[model samples]
Target: MYKKMIKNAAGVILSLSLAIASCGMTVNAQESKDKPSVTSNSLNAGGRVSKNQSGATATTTFSRPGNIRAKAIVYYRLGEDDYHSEDVKTNNAGGTTAFAEKKVSNANVVGAKGEHRVVYGDIIWNDETHIGLTLPNSKLK
Candidate 1:
């Protein structure tokens, strides 16, 4: 009886370990889905369109806090003359990083089959300088 109980306990422990390992993997996978699609060293920025193509998120990392901000712009366009821009900005006062994100549900223009054209993220220094970077376009359905 003692040996049987030990074996059962070992089996239960192994099963729990496996379950925990699988859960960790799932969390990592979800995080990778939100990873930035584009990064720019010059601007210290990253940007990506949402999986559903509804909007985008932008991030800028800074070494030290100052009069700095991060800007994210999501552009939608059906043609050269038809386009829209949605932007969001966030300021970093005394932190180590600054980021901004915005989602536009009505990104499509009226009566037009528009697409989420592209995403741009930038770092603005002292509210005067804008170092910008672009990411590849995301299609809209």
Candidate 2:
């Protein structure tokens, strides 16, 4: 009877140890997939044409706060309805990348002139959480 009880107690301890270890591993894996830190460097729209008064440039600058590689998408909205975008693949070492365009013409303007909003986001390991920001608006020209 003594030997049997000792065996049963050992089996129970082993089972609990396995359960605890598995739980810790699961938690660590989830933490590793957490959302990445994103930083907005700058967003601007400039270079308006004086004669036509219908052209300008949009620039979106952003970076991640880690060494891991990630993907970013910079979105631009000119006026109220005109929208444009650019995709960037961040360097593995992690640094700021800029996306700029001067393609907006007279046709893209909502009215005589409008303000442009530049927004950007960085996705960590392609996870669901997207970190981003929308900078202050500037004249679309």
Candidate 3:
């Protein structure tokens, strides 16, 4: 009887361990899928929209200060037909590797979804004039 009980308990423990491990893996996968950022060969940028969808904060980081002036632009849509964008500029000081960020507000506008992108007026040594966009994200009510 003692041996039988011990075997059953071990089986239950093993099953619980496997279940917990699978749950952890699922959570990690979902987290990775939701990452929000856009990058270019020379620069990296990202944005975060407010909970109420009234505004967003845009950020830009340079791999190396390539004597370029850049802008982080937040583009958003209202309802289904209205669209708007707001942008902020980098400091433009030469030869500095620092992250630039700006909070763009659209107090009159509110929405549930948007995208972030970076644009540069000056030249990037080996990069396009504008970087790709971040995955569109929805605001939580």
User: What C-alpha lDDT values do all the predictions have?
Assistant: 0.38, 0.33, 0.39
Q: How well is each residue in 42-122 modelled by candidate 3, as lDDT tens digits? A: 345333333224433333344443334333333344445334354444443332222222234433333212233334456
Model 2 reaches what TM-score against the true structure?
A: 0.24
**TM-scores vs. true structure, each candidate:** 0.35, 0.24, 0.37
Model 3 Cα shift for residue 127 (angstroms): 6.0
Q: Write the per-residue lDDT of candidate 1 for residues 1-141, one digit (tens) a residue.
A: 999999999999999999988884545554454444443344343333332244444444444444333444444444433333444444443222222222345444221111111122343432211222222354422
User: What TM-score does prediction 3 earn?
Assistant: 0.37
The runs of at least 3 residues in candidate 3 whose Cα sits more than 4 Å from the true structure, single-residue gaps closed, are 1-14, 17-34, 40-54, 92-141
Whole-model lDDT for model 1 versus the true structure? 0.38
Question: After superposing candidate 2, which stretches have Cα over 4 Å from the reference?
Answer: 1-80, 107-141
Task: Report the Cα RMSD per candidate.
Answer: 10.0, 17.2, 8.7
39-115 in candidate 2: lDDT tens per residue?
33233211111111232222223233433322223233445644433323333332333333334543332111112
Distance from true location, Cα of 124 in model 3, Å = 1.7
